[model samples]
Target: MEALTLTTPALLFSAVSLILLAYTNRFLGYASLVRQLYEKLKANPDQVLLDQIMNLRKRLYLIKNMQLLGVASLMFCVLSMFLIYIEVFLPAAYAFGLGLLLLIISLLLSGWEIKISVRALDLHLNDMEHFSEDNS
Candidate 1:
């Protein structure tokens, strides 16, 4: 394998930064949805709203984990760069590899969250379809 260089870890900086920004946006959107749901539930408690809230809760948990892993991956990349700067090639390589692994896991969790999100949207669509059918 080629020697670990500072540039190797530095390459992840932009990708990770973009990913973190996306994750933060997702988190903020969920926060807003939760607040809206809370008010709706208070006004008229329904099973469907309860289920949607539960789904959001799960998605929020996954997002939290995703953000945590992404941040950790970025931290590892920085650490790898620092290690390489100090002439610790072996540890630097390990750190870089771990950072990559964390990033991969974070992305996988993101995919799972997206799937859940789609399912939630599907539920809403189904409800609309049923309502239309009944009206028709």
Candidate 2:
């Protein structure tokens, strides 16, 4: 195999940075929503609200894990670059491969989270449809 170079691992920097940025934005949005729901629950908790809260809790955990894996991916990429700088080509390649795998895992988790989000929204739409039908 050809020797690993710092540029090879550096290619991941922008992609990883963008991913982390998006994850951070998602986390912040969830945090705000949770606080709003918490206040509402404090005043008057209902079954629907309770269910939403539970859903949000699961989403938050998933986001946390996604972020964790994303950061780990970034860390490994940096480590790989450093190893390459020191002429440790074999270890650098291994580290780069691990970093890529972790990135893939993070993306998969993101996709799962999106699927759950869509399902949650579908429940709301279904409920709205039922309410309209009952009125008719």
Name the candidate that leads on lDDT: 1
Q: Write the per-residue lDDT of candidate 2 for residues 9-85, one digit (tens) a residue.
A: 89897799999999999999989999999999999989988998889988899999999999999999999999988
For model 2 the TM-score comes to 0.94
Worst window of 10 by summed lDDT in candidate 1? 1-10
Q: What would the per-residue lDDT of candidate 1 be over residues 7-36, giving only the tens digit for each residue? A: 889999779999999999999999999999
Residue 60 error, candidate 1, Å = 0.3
Q: Which stretches of candidate 1 lie over 4 Å from their true place?
A: none
- Clash count in backbone of candidate 2: 0
TM-score of each: 0.98, 0.94
- Candidate 1's TM-score: 0.98
CA lDDT, candidate 2, residue 70: 94
